[model samples]
Target: MIEFLLTLAILAGINVLLACGFNLILGYGGLVSVAQPVFYAIGAYSSALLSMKLGLPVPLAMVLGALIAAIASFGLSLPSLRVSGDYLVIASMGFQLGIIHIINNVEFTGAASGLSGIVSAIESPWRSQIYAGTIIAICAVTILAIRWLVTGPYGRAITAMRNDEEVFASLGRDAVHIKVTLFAVGSGIAGLAGGLYAHYFLFLTPDQYGIFSSATLLTMVVVGGAATVRGPVLGAIFLTVLPEAIRFLNLPIAVMAPLQGVIFTGLVILFLFVKPEGLFGSKSGGGLDAWQSRAMSSSMRKGAK
Candidate 1:
């Protein structure tokens, strides 16, 4: 039971990081992207390959993996600047599909066979406990960092951009820079999660980081309350644990998997219809209208000065 609990906690921590990344772009920056899992796969593969084949230390490999994912984010963000709304969504979907195809076809990625033998940083009878602690600490620090970002100047600019890009530009803020920076940060976070995931499982498979995983991560941000610090964390915990909790029902394997999906879909629909702002989000009409309004006022004041 303790081992099961520890596993659940670690999974929740990873999902927290993933959802936070998605929130940074989709929730705070107002960019729609479905390519998060691509960065995730990059991070996983980079970490696995570096540690397993190149003989790099696990920690260093993880950092490099995240950096690589951040750099790769530019490929999408640059193109995204030309589109918005549905078009941007379509572009992101294409990127997601394209990356998956590359992963499946690339020999170094182990192609459809997947990679194995990921060395865990923590080794011992206590590895589970230590890993869970590490994940928790990382997640706590990340949540605090995200809180800081959302409350700082960049946060204000992004919120303003989300509300009205033209107005944000008119106020002397460069929407392009803000969007690109947020995208990179978000993708980097996803990469970090991926590295952690790879080391924890000590295995890698292309199928694990597919469109379904992307949707699950997005669902966490949406259900948790996008644009809020605690929302994604809460949502990640709920969703990560919910499936495991359902397993206690002892339902047939075929019935259990689809049942979990049904429950998840129901929750998402319920949230969309009944509480679109999410549990922790503001009840006001716009997603972050209050913050945007304040930002606009502040910008106006600066202009007058």
Candidate 2:
């Protein structure tokens, strides 16, 4: 039972990082991207491979892996400059799928068979406890950093850009710089989550970082409240526990996966329609509705011009 609880806590911590990382991109930058898992995969693979092949320490490998993911984020950020809304979504999705395909086909990535034998930084009888503590620490630091970032001048610029990119640019703020920086930092955080996952599971598979995983992270942000410090954390913990809570029903194994999917889908729909602001989102109806409104306004302005 202790082990089970620890595992849940660990998963929750990882999800917290993933959701918060994405909050920077979507919530603050108002960029719609579903390619977070790509960075997650990159971090896991880079860290695992470095540890296994080059015998690098797991801690150092994780940092380098995160750095690589941050650098790779430029690929998406640069192209993103030319796209927005649905186009950006499609582009990001295509990028994600393409990366997954490459990982699936690549020999060094272990192909479809996946990679294992990830080294742990600490060898102790209380490894699970230690890992859980480490993840908690990381989560706290991440949340604090995000809070600090979004509450200062950077945050104001982000809000300005989100409201009207053209106006923000006209005011002498470099929109390109903000976009690139947001992507790099957000993707780097995701890479760190991926590194933690790799070290904990000691395994890697392309399937683990799929579209569904990306959706799950999005759901977390939307459900808990986006553009808020505590929202993603709440969403992460709730979703992480939700699956385990479902298991108590003792349903047939076949129905379990589908049931959870239904629940998640239902929750997202309910939130979108009834509480788009999410459980802890701003009272101004922020989530997807705000995004849609902003997009439509931008389009109408463009048409008028």
Residue by residue across 18-50, what tens digits does model 2's lDDT show? 999999999888999899999999988998888
Task: After superposing candidate 1 on the true structure, give the runs of residues whose Cα lies further than 4 Å from its correct spot.
Answer: 285-305
Q: What's the TM-score of each model vs. the native?
A: 0.91, 0.94
Give the least accurate 10-residue stretch of model 1, judged by summed lDDT.
Answer: 285-294
* TM accuracy, model 2: 0.94
Please give the lDDT score at residue 248 for candidate 2: 75
Candidate 1 local lDDT, 46-136, one digit each (tens): 9888898999999999998998999999999998999986798889989988988888998988889988778887889999899999999
Judge candidate 1 at residue 277 and give its lDDT: 70
Best by TM-score: 2
